[model samples]
Target: MPQESSHRVVLMVDENSNPFEMSCAIEVFGLPRPELGRDLYDFRLCAAEPRTRMRDGFFTLSDVADLGAAEEADTLIVPNRPDTDAPRAPHVLDAVRRAHARGARLVGFCSGAFTLAEAGLLHGRPAACHWMWADSFRARFPGVRLDQDVLFVDDGDILTASGSASALDLSLHVVRRDHGAEIANHVSRRLVFAAHRDGGQRQFVERPVPHIRDESLAPVLTWAQERLGEPLTVADLAARARVSQATLHRRFRAQLGTTPLAWLTGERVNLARRFIERGEKRLDVVAARSGLGTAANLRARLRQETGLSPSAYRRRFGPSGGEPVTP
Candidate 1:
């Protein structure tokens, strides 16, 4: 596990802050997990003022910490701010910059990306935001490389989630990074959410409306997911979907926001992660089962995607085979 600390994660709030996203952060970082036998983080809710009214003025946040809390945080999380185009308070921007300058990890959810970009932290760095705000974000901060496809973008100390639900993904990802996949999965189980989700927000954005029936690509995706152990290619997927390869490529880009090969690689990596977590010690077996062809290939792919070797990943997140040590 990474070094544990009584690290403070200050959730910076404002009049435009979304309560739901803040609650998500609190749920992930605030609540104590006895299963781990130690507090993972010290969570604080901070605002421009001690007591601030939330978005829509329907609810008021009372007894919140002041912006000074952000300056002292180890991680500063900015939840969904209501308007991306509106000016942020000078104090808030200053607090965020101070936190970042002091080496605190900066996180933004939804419109909060605008705050990070506005503070100049996202210049030339990859960022993610809700697809609906893509145009506005580009117009406001053209220097920031905005990837509207992924659920979240983790550019080292700077992280951004695409939307409200994706905020949970980002928080869990932080936990996974700091603690391990095991603890993050435990938190996920407690919250009744998948530790990791398939695909990205692009799939949702493409068809925002609920599909009462399966879309054209749904069956093919399901089929591919089930057959990851097999050697699956674009031709195989296209044949399964009964569409031309070119049409299948169009469908994947439209619905999944990635190429077929990229999606396949992601799925294989996910399966490999699961295998490693379950104590699959043989890298060769893991590679063959995940259809990555060989152990060397698996090593390269896992390193590229997760920056961890197979054995290192297993050591961090694999079955403990015993009790967890309390920090």
Candidate 2:
């Protein structure tokens, strides 16, 4: 039997829902765990209607709770909805808004972000949704800060995940926040997944997606990543790739769909983030080592990208001591 608690989590499911996402939620919160020696979560599966049919033609009956349940839940989870481009139900949108208004944490996994955006809960908040639907999501919610380069975005009370595997990362992050690293690590071990994955959705973007291969920029990118701390320019990159700067730019635009400077900045930022996470606190040192030149430059760049100050980010992810030595 599950322990009764005032704090509850309501997972909203609907017809044609992706069973894998639903199962991800259940695997994280619904399963019984006596080893933890306490109630982990009060998880409930509720739907808009009483009977919901999955994608594979299986029907599962739900004790369907009304919109009122959203008002009472401490956390509201919107799992992957139908893959179609259809908008979320009006009632479901209202429920999500009401729950958010009542201080409940709202979570969206994969296409579930569409529902949150429709509810107006993601306005001005940084959100991560499936890369494939990023364009549509941005078009629909113009005010929301849609970041396609992260696995998950934990923006205070609201959380959004990129896609399927990212759901696990977000859930593990939640467990870490609520129960600390020890418990979160245990849960991760039980699931046979990494306790934490390095990098973000930037690492998962479809590289070489199109069959038309351009071997031109590939070696240049590999070389650039290897020497992130070294000062690099378009001329240098072009020279290394044995191509004109114009040709290099065209190849980057055609293959990576971004400018050379933008890609280099992204790589530098990624490196700085890794250093910060490893307890490196001296902003000046981090900036120089990551090729951003100065502490002020790093601060401006990091703030523009992640909305976090160097000190704040270091405090959150860096080592226990104040500043880490330059490595």
Best by lDDT: 1
Predicted candidate 2 versus true structure: per-residue lDDT over 230-324, tens digit per residue? 89887889899888888777777665556788888877886787677666778888998899999999999888766678887666655664333
Give me the runs in candidate 2 sitting further than 4 Å from their true place: 1-6, 56-58, 198-327
What are the models' TM-scores? 0.79, 0.62
Give all candidates' CA lDDT scores.
0.83, 0.75
Residue 234 of model 1, lDDT score: 89
